[model samples]
Target: MPPFVLRSPEVLLSVPTPADIDRIAVVCTDPAIAEWTTVPSPYTRADAETFVTGMVVDGWARETMFTWAVRAPGRPDGTVLGMMAIGLIPGGPGDAHAGEIGFWTAPDARGRGLTTAAGRLAADWALDPSGLALERLQWRGFEGNWASRRVAWKLGFRYEGLLRRHGVRNGTVCDDWIASLLPEDPREASEPWPQEAPTS
Candidate 1:
């Protein structure tokens, strides 16, 4: 476990500093991430640098995205385990009260439920009045990414529908699994919605 600082329940998210970029980069560049996500294949240090400097900074400065650094459970700055992003939230003047959540973990950190935990935390914060005006939290993932879909389902996101040819990954059009959690739903529950998978 790694040390970590929680974002105010109001903010619902936190940003990773440049110091955490290297470890994050290692995970982002892993074959699993590239294979499942829109992240560029052969992800490099340059891409990682952009995420820490240009992208994260610019998104924050412009209020386009809300992000968090997922640290190892007990170590605040031990290493960047992965990251989470709340995309397209209704924060700007003309924005709507909707948001999409996204996250990825290091290959070494996979299957540990960090993502599911982070999702619950972020969603709980996002739906609070002090945070974003999230009437709904949406999750969209490539159809074949069972791990990602599992995370969303574990967080009580109901599968709403599928988007055919909804996203392009490496020049290939892929279907997407679309899901959403309503503000009235109970988030942060140890148990999932009845329709969610039954864990042994």
Candidate 2:
């Protein structure tokens, strides 16, 4: 599939380019992002350049994964707000349409719903008949990643319980929370989302 762009009222999603290396490196260095994601610890300029110029470029070229750099609308060419991607998940017979979604937001961009918006756009595109025609988009995050789980929930991904020691992250086995979104699911929260009580 050829690379494409997606835009919403507040954000723009485009394929990452070499120009984004500096920002990518900066964002990936955040301890929070590094802890919850697979990005290398102490992310470096070299790593960011390789990711943008090599992994990202090759993934799109092979049509095996689609990654987008999220930015604010006013200065779409400026700093990246986050990154989101949807990639093929090899499946067994009768499950060829499976795909997976992953994302991370810059520290400054968190709590503003930028990643949620970007995720919705990517999910819609992936499930559209005119797009990848994927039957479902799966989402997974470390067990304690309530922020990521909340984003998936807000986008109507049905909670599918936890997978014990399902994958490795930062060199350690970790449990993951799983969810899935289908084309027919409503694009709104599917269950009650309670907020923490205010601190005294």
Candidate 3:
């Protein structure tokens, strides 16, 4: 229900166009994207190119994963805001129905409510039955990554628990926070989640 033509203000699962690569690449290279997330330590233009042109596109085409590129809303024209993604974690229906969310913002775009905004959008899209019959959507981040945790909390992902030494972060093992949103979730702080309850 968003106004952007290439991607919805609500979500952006579609593959980004070649025209969008440069702006997206700039955001990808931010040290923030490297420090907290699983992206290669020294992010590069080739990594960005592979992601936009290869990984994201191929994943969607193969029905193996989902990804999105966030864009700003209500400007004179659309402004590239950030990016987000949800991919089916390994498992069968009972397990695979649960997807995982990941995202980042342009350095200048942070602290402006952009990450939370994009989280709500991507959550809705990921839960859309026509898109993916997700029973739950998860957000996992290093225990100390307050920014990542905040985005998950703002979007209504309850803290399930923490896993000790659950993730390899910046070459060190770290605890992780596991949070989720069920298909039946009634409210997402910043945007509307699906109305229908999750099916078993």
- Against the reference, the lDDT scores of all candidates come to 0.73, 0.87, 0.72
Q: What is the lDDT of residue 156 in candidate 1?
A: 80
48-166: candidate 1 lDDT, tens digit per residue:
88888887777667765677787655545556666887776556333667888888887776777777777777787667787766787899988777788878877888878889999
Clashing pairs in 1: 2-72, 2-74, 2-75, 3-74, 3-75, 3-76, 4-76
Ranked by lDDT, top first: 2, 1, 3
Badly placed stretches (over 4 Å) of model 3 are: 1-14, 74-79, 92-95, 189-200
Candidate 2 deviant stretches above 4 angstroms: 74-76, 92-95, 194-200
Clashes of each: 7, 0, 0
Best by lDDT: 2
Better of 2 and 3 by TM-score: 2
lDDT of 2 by residue, 1-200 (tens): 66778999978899888889998998898989988998888899999999998888888998878998999876557688899999888771246587889999999999998998999999998888888788888999998777888899999899888899997889999999899998888888988874534555
lDDT of 1 at 154: 79
The best-first sequence of candidates by TM-score reads: 2, 1, 3
TM-score of each: 0.83, 0.93, 0.81
Q: Which stretches in model 1 have alpha-carbon errors above 4 Å?
A: 1-14, 89-94, 188-200
